[model samples]
Target: MTSLLSAQESGIVLGSPLFAHINPRQLPQLLTQMQASRRRYNQGDWILNEGDPCQAFGLILSGTVQVLRDDFMGYRSIINNLESGDLFAESYSLAPGRRLTVSAMAAAGETGILFLQQDFFTDREQISRGGQDSAQVRANLTAILATKNLFLNRKLSYLSQRSTRQKLIAYLSDQARACGSRRFEIPFNRQELADFLCVERSALSHELARMQQAGLLQTRRSYFELAEQLPETDSPI
Candidate 1:
């Protein structure tokens, strides 16, 4: 991990949810207080591995972070993809003494992240982190954690779908909604998309082809456009 954050890097850190209401001038002192550092990784690099003791809360500073689960035979499943400004590992970090159940990996080039070493909300932790008490930062951290938890429940809903088409529709619809447009680019390619949906790669490809032919959606690589009237019937859980 790098000890210093460049001017541009400092802007990214200050703009993050965890630093909400914090002044730019106070960042260096705050980073020092929390024992946090910035780091960047190349594509496919491991940011956090499963079963490892979790001590820090990680925030994606740039590029993408793919949270993955592995099976006994080493097959991998994509739990979720987090983009720049997204937070990860907060749950474990807050609880303390818990090991990670999934791994976080770089999805593409130069994935940068910030790791803050203690529970942001705990009074003792706040005192230990230099007695710089800021209620705004604590409120911001609580809101961010709650938002992440809601998204996790949404992911669980997608994973429970019985069909590849159902899973694809559910996930894509949410992506479109998130972007506020019918057209949007997703973080995953075909294989990674299959892993995210917990479906076979071949099945996912075939289903996409069928959906395109049926005029339900049009996709090229990672970009997609959903028909105004989606074919999804079941309400999202």
Candidate 2:
């Protein structure tokens, strides 16, 4: 685990939404009280595996984490991608026995995580005062969980589309709206995007080519530009 001093100096912890509601002056006390630990992970590192004991949840201070689930036969599906300021594994960490169903892996480059154990919230005497301090912590946790739930709902809406084209359109349209621009960069690469959309890479590539030819969009690696207005129905060609 990295030291608190280093985390503070790096600004990773201070910048994260997990600590956004915390007062700057109280940050040291909060960290010490929660026994928060910081750790670094390289690309492709498995931060947590399915069935692993989820004693704690982590906030991404930098870089990204890919949440994936694998079946009994070893087929894997990407559930979600989390970036800086996002929290992961809170639901599992708070549950009894605290066993995780999904695996979290480091993506892109080096990632920094601020881990807070379950006791951080449960042990009121240690981390929270009776009045405003306790209420603020609860508010922070509620906000995080609500945001995560909404993100999952959006992912589900994207995945529910029947065709590869529809999925692509849904994802791109959502991204454009989120970015407030027709031109944007997506976080996932070819294979990762294929996995994320639950489509075969070859099929997705073929669809992209078709869409480009149809004047739907243009793509160069992760960057994309919507060349024309999307159709009402994103049905398969």
Candidate 3:
């Protein structure tokens, strides 16, 4: 079977895990009644442009995409980096017709996405038929939103700190935990990491060199692995 068919046969339903925030029962109705398509994007392709109308809710099946915005002064700031199992194009769920404030682009690898039309989620009866208590539903949604808010806050905090060392340390620590592995690969390359962190590439490189010298981490091409004895504060859980 193809990957898509295998996924379906495995009973891997939509809106699970990352989207477990939504009621599971509602998910079947949400998916079956709505349209979904698997689309591919080559590396460096734009999935969405800034100011585009948010028309659908997207889920990342594989690969990485960076969310960024170009300022009036023509400087680009990366808001976030999304990887497999992440959700995107979520604005339509909150506010239809709202323009995407940031642009999304496939990063190093090809990306696969499944998107649902926004209007499909607006059916109150369908949403409510899941039989979850109002409080339970609100709590689930809150947890989902809270996870996103926390991630944003962490990114902001990292950017606010002085020195590339601090930012790099924070980023690596965050990634280690997110990947749930002591030895894990970063989702982006050095250049992409520098861009996402809003730092000069040369400066970031120097800091990374210093980090390697300090025996905190090791880099092999685009992948980084945390040395067994990273500084106490730098070690990921």
lDDT scores of the candidates, listed in order: 0.82, 0.81, 0.68
* Model 3 steric clash pairs: none
Q: For model 2, how does the per-residue alpha-carbon lDDT over 1-237 read when each residue is reduced to its tens digit?
A: 134746543366666666665566676666676677888999999999998998888888888999999889766688888898788998898787868889999987999888888886776584545345445665788788898888778778778888999899989988998999999999888888988888889999999999999999999999999965896544222
Candidate 2's C-alpha lDDT? Answer: 0.81
Every candidate's CA RMSD: 2.6, 3.2, 4.6
Better of 1 and 2 by lDDT: 1
* Models ranked on lDDT: 1, 2, 3
Select the stronger candidate by TM-score from 1 and 3: 1
Window of ten residues with lowest summed lDDT in model 2 = 1-10
How many residue-pair clashes does candidate 3 contain? 0
Worst 10 residues of 1 by lDDT: 127-136
Expressed as tens digits, the lDDT of each residue in 1-237 for candidate 3 is 233424542134333343444554455444555465668899999998888787776677777888888889777777778776667667445585588888889876778777666544566765565344333433544566678887788888778767788787777877887888767786677777888889988898998998889888888766788866544332222
Q: Model 2: which residue pairs collide?
A: none
Which candidate gets the maximum TM-score versus the true structure? 1
TM-scores for all predictions: 0.90, 0.89, 0.74
TM-score, prediction 2: 0.89
